[model samples]
Target: MTSTSTAPGAAAGPDAPRPAHRETLRTHHGDTVTDPFEWLRDKEDPQVIAHLEAENAYADARTAHLAGLREELVQEFVGHTQETDLSVPVRRGDWWYITRTTAGDDYPAFTRVAESPELPRGAGGVPAIEPGELLPGEQMLLDAQAAAKDAEFFSLGGLAPSPEHDLLAHAVDLAGDERFTIVVTDLTTGTVIDESVTGTGYGLAFSADQQWIFYARVDDAWRQHQIWRHRIGGDPSADELVLEEPDERFTVWFERSRDGKALVLQSSSTTTAEAWILDLADPTAAPRPAGGRRDGVDYTVEWAGDRLLVVHNDGVEGFALAEAPLDAADSSAWTPLLSAGEGERLLGVESFAGCVALELRAGGLAAVRVIPRRADGSLDVEAAWDVDHGGELDVVELDTNPAWDSPALRYQLTSLLTPATVAQVDVASGERTVLRLTPVPGYDPELYREQRLWATAEDGTAVPISLVARKDVPVDGTAPGYLYGYGSYEVSIDPSFVPTRLSLLDRGLVVAIAHVRGGGEMGRDWYEQGKILAKKNSFFDFVAAAAHLVDQGLVAPDRLSAEGRSAGGLLMGAVANLAPERFRAIIAGVPFVDALTTILDPSLPLTVGEWEEWGNPLESEEVYRYMKEYTPYANVRPVEYPAIFASTSLNDTRVFFVEPAKWVARLRETVTSDQAERPILFRCEMVAGHGGRSGRYRKWEQRADELAWLLDQLGATARV
Candidate 1:
């Protein structure tokens, strides 16, 4: 698809191409709805492909003026980033694993070096390395750039080294379909030994003996429902089926415990979960249940020394910590180690030989606390203390402390202005040392500032907003602002650093994150208050956030823009309908705009499993009506809307391209707004999936395009 050349500030090009409409009747809960654009769901239809391509051409024509700006932004990203860099090495077994990236390569190379007395731990128990420098005797494990050289799209699913560190089992997806193939390599000889497993999910674990590897397999609906054990260098057809989840709502996953003594197999739904323990010593033994699955109770188990550390949300909304003996790890054997706090959410627990790190959230920010361990490895709760982050908005969490016996704890810290930093703390003496700060060649943190603001929702609930901009940017109402949000599935959109965002902030734009409901930022109750029957709260909360910014005289409403992706994209659609006049434009990426319809069809990927998050509309009349009230596609009326840009990928299994394609079509036909002034644009990535692109450069290009369009809409295009 090609577009006609259009100069900056040019008139609308040849009227946005419109797709043909065909009605399909969808009946659920005794209600029949006519979906005019439902035919777009058929990806195989030639007409559908043509219509999408036409939309693509139109979008390209409309945004052609931003070509220069896009290029400049891309350059800014490249300049700010240290093109050739090395990640802080992580120690596991006898090796120090390190990832390296070259100046122009799109992917990173994984390699490891054997531990030795010559290469001692530098400051804070981390290796001292400069940019592009390699540790001595470093051997190549996987060169992602080399592996992705021939594929249009490539994703690394899982990389697991055997306990003996002789075999490396890795999974790769070349089609962006999320189905991966497991390949085993003899690390000692640098040769591939097995390519026998295919159509598997994203996790892999090896038996302690290194003879077998366990992986998950997805069903036709794209749910990971089966766990299989494949012998090293054995035929895929003879792989043993370890377990299969019969319930559609549940998905199976397995991971090696922190201690590396057992493989923890988990079967989880949105609101419930259970785990099985497979002793690594006996890979063929029957799995032992840690706890029985109870409705509405979610828990995760990790082996900690002689006991099991359990983080569960049973009697507590924000979750609590419990401990059980490894021999009798049933629910009845659990005893409280840390009781639930009123305003704090216990996210998870990571155990070390000398201490346990509790990753938790409190006051709308992430923090970590360390509890000293007794001589026998049980947590000494009375001696616990929270880590001192020393920054107002710094987000701190436990990093990869893979070795159970390490005396120090590694944690990462970052905020809106600060780049990512890895630091370690001595558990016994509480001595913190800065290990390595991610190298950003030309970034100056001093030029940026971060602030926290709370906006009251319509129901009197306070939503937190994190704002970041150039230090010189004023708080007056004249500046343009971009608000972002994602409030679904308890996923918290924390304040973190992004180098590319510098392009926006440098241009005098204020970028903010709305920590609204349905997110785990506050706690479990925070998420519960915004999902299912209360899902509309997410939309209202976001609209309220925009209104708060305008009312606070921080940003001009007419110059404000908003963006969200996936579920957040759902937020964008809902708010565009709920309060179109509150902003200048909206960008929805792989948006779940057609929520009710997708959730009603059980055959769709993630549909049946989403019943707990979004109530089942097929079985409940109330759910049908509730979803109908705010679902973007069904609620589109002949009302004015902000300039809308929706992006989707053809192979996106999570939020199918049809959702956005249909939503954009409805908006073009139904909105009463002037198409020339507030044109609705849709871009479909023909060769991509849920995430638009794979390689770093291609991903950055997509970002630059979106940012350039947003800058244009906000009238902040001129580089400051």
Candidate 2:
């Protein structure tokens, strides 16, 4: 974890550590690939530790000239952000829940006020809760900053209150791993109870009467596959196991019904899903599936009034809405509430007292629609989002609506040039009430311009790209560009404002996101086209986006930098191998470069569960060959490469630190050293995990370092 920097102004010249080769042969499908740096995967070995530390030393030496720039970036970030801020208070049954952040603190403070019994709405069509407004007689419920004072890696996972508001159950993970410790606090006495469940997932739901709590537990392979229920005062070992899933692919998400009388859990994989319901009134009952689970079908269910409201794709191309009797939780007995359709994708649903909110995406843009419930217990779908629409890169989804009987539907909306704003829509009149807009000091949204562009892929597919830059920066291919992409797991990087990007924009760097086929940006079809045997589509799409940006005169090829993290890191690696000349530099954080090697072994963490997403390489020779062809570690060549900055954490559970460690080591040995002064830096966080450094200050420092490196590689002048 310790490293020495080179002399000042030495970044222009390189002095890097050359790791030794301990060749390891990996044979599969009657083929062998020699991995000379595979020995670096052994994290416990002192030799491996020394090599990682030496790489850290090399990175320190390589970026020595940017120390001043990094500091200046950090200071600029701090100036534009309000360190001390307050979130809009949400009112529950008997408490006004508020989250407050103090300057210089890594976490926020969760508090509550008891004076509010009946929630009040704004009269002039404004949000009732305003930022920084104080509620009388506030009580400190759980101060995360204070709780995380002693832990180096602290994650405030689940913060929930009992139905009666007397018991507060919160989970914390101190090791950067998602496995948390559920701690119960007696809110009546303002003290933490000794009862706690260790090694549990970050999910907690209290029963209607506050007698039982449902939480998820991670299996040996780090999958949350079990739901356990514990009595308020019972021992952790004596907790009841409500359900145990033997399937390794599906992960379980635990939740309580709006009425809090039943436990609702959804077990889902990448392409298929199923839901289970257990009446919390009877703690000894088994959970029953909401509907039959069919392969290639994904659906979720929720309780509203006397029936189960379902969002499924059984008969529709995109998805449809249906409802069934509470007892008959099967597809046959379900009646169509919103009929099947195309073009408009049914995202999700949330029920309130008077209406059901539908999150729908049309033409790849998201919006919230209100479907009011009639007196006869039916939904009005004519009021959907098809009425009027502005097809822009925007996000609209259901926000926190805890009260089952609330009259309004709360939602959050944001776009590329707009900060996030919380709003509540009146179900009847559709009047909007904006609660809060995130603050960015000394900044104006009008100063920037954002646009959505299409890039033509090799196969004639049009991939979407979201670009944002300062209006003053000329679009003449002379400005530096930062291109980002993550095309895996059907996870979409939606259009949202990022204040931190101002540092790059003001420095004349254009930021863009390549929404390739693997992401859910378009629809499920988009994801299917980029996974399994067709995974190469994602890599090719990214390459096309980079080329399109250059063709559009946005940035020169030699001035563009590409960056991605985790699975996105895999994207960066793939593109680096496919078209190294397109980018001047690449930043990979906790990258999954050794995909074929990891998937071939089932014993490693997350490998077995990832079979469906990346294909089971151990069983299928075709899958093995396909993965090996594009796997970054397997594809390193003798060609000249871009200046690379690879980072990984020792405790990363999802993407093991070994992947990046091995990739970096091999790149140093294989890639030609003719451009020796071109930096190929590796950074290892010894005490962190997949998410990198935990604290805000530490993460800011890391971001600044990355920006400094990026500016240096792009030949951009620092603001300082």
Clashing pairs in 2: none
Instruction: Report residue 54 deviation for candidate 2 (angstroms).
Output: 2.0
Stretches of candidate 1 above 4 Å error?
A: 1-11
Q: Per-prediction RMSD in angstroms?
A: 2.4, 3.2
Tens-digit lDDT track for model 1 on 362-474?
Answer: 77888998999888666889899998777878899888888989999999999998899999999989999988888787788888889999999999999999999887878
Highest lDDT among the candidates is held by which one?
Answer: 1
TM-score each candidate.
Answer: 0.98, 0.95
- In terms of lDDT, model 1 sits at 0.87
Clashes of 1: 0
Off by over 4 Å in 2: 1-14, 115-134, 339-341, 386-391, 673-676
Best by TM-score: 1
Q: For each candidate in the order shown, give its overall lDDT on alpha carbons.
A: 0.87, 0.80
Local accuracy of candidate 2 as per-residue lDDT tens digits, 512-594: 99998888788778888889899999999999999999999998877888999998998989998999889888999999999
